[model samples]
Target: MAAIQPPKAQYQQVAALLRERIHDGTYTADQPLPSEPQLSAELGVSRQTINRAMNLLRSEGLVRVRRGFGTFIRGVPQVTRDAKKRYAARNQGTGAGDVEIKALGLTPRTEYVEIGRVPAPAAVATVLSIETGAPVLVRRRHLFANDEPTQLADSYIPWDIAEGTELLNRNVGRGGSYTRLAELGHGPVRFTEEVTVRTATDDEASLLELDGGQPVIDITHIAWDAADRPVEVALHVMPGNLWRLRYDWDDPTADEYPTVDGEV
Candidate 1:
């Protein structure tokens, strides 16, 4: 028999009960939790205690409060972003992270997509070797994993390269933009990425449904063509709590040593 433990504090007891429900699937990711008054009446706790418990869960990254919108449980981080595999899949004609998420049996989708010509921002111009304020084709979208918003992705390409191409379409179809670039004879032969972590801006927090003060992973990626010309620049911003990045590469020094015995 389990030991008879001392009673938990009112707020902690409330939290424990809610956490149990969350884990047991009584409260799923798609639905919001009961209102404070509802929970208070059901659990026979003071509204103050319920609020305190919710706040605790929010701080733990296990729940999110959407102001007017009710609170919702945040499930475990279910997406692993393996950089090498994503690029490799793209080369095989997969688009928009579909293959990666599908492999996990989760739905990957772009909830919002906008495409048009915009003057290049200074930073984007520098990366694409174009003049600031020059016309450039941009595609921006909000990506989702199942019903959960995952990331914001934006891609920029020089107007000369993007004009009249399907890259300007809201849906670039399978294999994504890279495959389209390849058809134009500018397929990316090399790529580079710069990654950083920082606090989310208000707009970012709203879009990704992140709690205030939550951090985000920002990635800047550039693709180069066979002529060594910069063909595309992309920015991907993701909620820091919901995803983990992965990188794998062969050891550089291994090539320097053929064998321990110095054989051919």
Candidate 2:
């Protein structure tokens, strides 16, 4: 005999109905959704079912809940420009060079947990073109905005080049290492970057206040001077959902390109 499927409750049915209404624009962006008790009575469902449905919407970014302020329909996702050249143009004259947080459009507050010379790890040595165990200046910083962790940056600069500079002794508010590097005569005119995404580790989740299983974006950058010498190697981990990467390209006839539809 075939196994029987469980029967759906009236409350489940009602929750589905309400979800459809919201999706169909019955509840517009930033519009206040009906209270649980009100929706319960109107849809003839229990409050618990309505709550569950709302939770689903929240996870999807379709709704937002404000403590003591009720839930509201989320605004449409902002459109992001994808041209790398356009991105550079937009950032031009923004004083974004050298760890300027404003160029990233994020107000940065930094916790300078450590700043000193350390033997380069194998990975750092490879990136900086230094031998293993070579001393390098390591700067570990926790960057925050609006009291939330925005990024964790670990910068490695060869000690021979970086030592005795204001970059070593300055606090977070002074300027970014990139800017200081220029002042010390090793300015970078070119940068190469690699980006990846993965689920956050336990420690990362705790520090970033991210939910378990939430993915974060990692960006590794190697900056080189005009002489093609590597000057700085930095790693950054950022919240996936709160940030968007934009690139503007000049070629209008390029054949191959990339695209995204919802979560990857």
TM-score of each: 0.77, 0.62
Q: Residue 78 error for model 1, in Å?
A: 2.8
- Candidate with the greatest lDDT versus the true structure: 1
List, residue by residue over 1-264, the lDDT tens digit for candidate 2. 989979876655665776688878887755688899998888776789888777656545456665577787644331232323321342343322222345446455778778989999998899999999999998888876645566787889999888787667745223356567777788777877788999889998778765556678887778898789998898878766655667544697543555454332
Q: Give each model's whole-structure lDDT.
A: 0.85, 0.69
Worst 10 residues of 1 by lDDT: 91-100
The Cα error of candidate 2 at residue 16, in Å, is 11
What is candidate 1's lDDT per residue for 116-223, written digit by digit as tens? 999999999999999999999988888877767888988899999999988888778678788889999999988888999999999999999887888899999899
Give the C-alpha miss distance for residue 257 in model 2, angstroms.
17
The TM-score obtained by model 1 is 0.77
| Clash pairs detected, candidate 2 | 82-247, 83-247, 83-248, 83-249, 84-247, 84-248, 84-249, 85-248, 98-179
